[model samples]
Target: MQPDVPTASCCGEADAYFADEIHVRDGKTYAIITDDRPDEPRGRPHVDIGTEIEVPDHKLKWDKGNPTGHGIIFLSRNRYVFCYVQPGGA
Candidate 1:
């Protein structure tokens, strides 16, 4: 399951470079995982918005919005997971 369309503060607009992954935790709160490829070490994970991820055997794609892109998680046959950024940050 996915949360409501997060406010602009959470999810940014959509774009080609705005690819991301939707992570689901026991059907509760949702978080967006992205990959980061900084020239310098950020001393953190490389997962940042727009980073391509391998989502199991499921197929993913963009859903809606502009400026930033959102990922739609396809779980199984009819199950689906919607991933979005919480805005303010990319």
Candidate 2:
């Protein structure tokens, strides 16, 4: 139910930033949305969205976000995708 809320306002290592490792059609179920990272807009500019990434054992769970962990994947160009990953405790 909460996933329906837009993530445009969420950035940095925040929980309300993203959802769990739930899959959805980019152009269908829910549109992939993005917003400038106010704290670090140019953070990791090399990475893009939709890129697959392996999680580091220590870097699994993020600071927030349901304690479900999150990871970043590269996208088309200078964009980074924020998504869920297997929780470290899992």
Candidate 3:
């Protein structure tokens, strides 16, 4: 989905999240990734398009209690990637 909503997370208020492809529409699967860490500031985090990453299973937490079943992918002690799973999804 193309999320035009601005979020406090990610790059703060400077830019809105979901400007790039996050999850494929064909399936529920999404690529786990880390910040690309550019040599210079780009105002927002960047991820390599085809670079899929792997983290501990425990880090991927799914919140079934939420209406959207939103989950959090904890990448590090202070970094995390929020997964917004749409309703009616597995």
Candidate 4:
């Protein structure tokens, strides 16, 4: 499924973290990657859109403790994975 958001990136915070698109959206999935920079901005963080996240079913780490069950995993280091389950990561 295509992303509802029009644009797909907002990581232009002047020499900010290095964000790269490992895989472009193939009509379903794309990856917005970033490095583990020590100077990552905590406030007013950069945003990325028009990106696709591929969360393999096996990649998920279920707590198996919570009633609703949660997945605590990330596909990148740029902190781009700060939201809920990525596009095609189910």
Candidate 5:
């Protein structure tokens, strides 16, 4: 069975993107993976594997992974987090 893919109310917004579908497994939700953004800076630093990244905890569904105590884990640059109020989104 497929996970419930929520609709992103923020569409056509500037400097932002949204996922069309997502998958939930082991109580953790994940979206389709991506690498880098079109507007990404040329020399922007890349986040390494296992490094803790900040994510909206309120939108997170689980708690057991990182410093935030929110189970939202960003294990790769391709891991796009699914949050309730996306940054720069409407």
Candidate 6:
């Protein structure tokens, strides 16, 4: 997590949100799009690789090997949800 990442919320939440738009660059999960809002500048919109993410119901190992980007929403460390966003749209 860089110092200039934007913060986001799902619909309406109080906790801080951390997002990383990763792509397979030389077989590495590189942070191409980040949102650290209120602390860092928002990055430009870009298309991510991956299929639609289903809302997670339990804690699972986040596989970064996938070339597609996945969006996840979690309630603390227990309840978790996953989804996918099209680059720049909320």
The lDDT values for all models are: 0.33, 0.31, 0.32, 0.34, 0.33, 0.30
> Residue 5 of candidate 3: its Cα lDDT?
28
Instruction: List model 2 lDDT by residue over 1-90, tens digit each.
Output: 112223333234432222223333442222222323442445433322332333322323234333434332222232333333333453
CA displacement after TM-score superposition, residue 27 of candidate 2 (Å): 29
Best TM-score among the predictions, by candidate number: 3
lDDT per residue as tens, model 5, 7-74: 43211223223332345666654443232344345332344333333443444433222232212222
**Poorly placed runs, candidate 3 (over 4 Å):** 1-42, 65-90
Root mean square deviation (Cα) for candidate 2: 12.0
Q: What ranking emerges by TM-score with the best candidate at the front? A: 3, 5, 2, 1, 4, 6
How well is each residue in 11-30 modelled by candidate 6, as lDDT tens digits?
A: 22332133444344444332
Clashes of each: 20, 5, 0, 5, 0, 11
**Candidate 3 residue-wise lDDT, 1-90, digit = tens:** 212223423223212122122354444445433333351353544444344433323322233322333222322223344333222244
> How high is each candidate's TM-score?
0.25, 0.26, 0.30, 0.25, 0.28, 0.24
Residue 39 C-alpha lDDT in model 4: 39
Residue 37's C-alpha lDDT in candidate 3? 39
Query: Can you give the lDDT of residue 15 in candidate 2?
Result: 27
In candidate 2, what residue range of length 10 has the lowest lDDT sum?
27-36
Show the colliding residue pairs in model 4: 8-49, 8-50, 9-49, 30-52, 55-89
Model 6 TM-score, 2 decimals: 0.24
**Residue 52 CA displacement from its true place in model 6, Å:** 18
Put down candidate 4 lDDT per residue, 1-90, tens digits, no spaces.
112232543223332333244443544433453434443553334445433456333332222222222222232355444222222233
Better of 1 and 3 by TM-score: 3
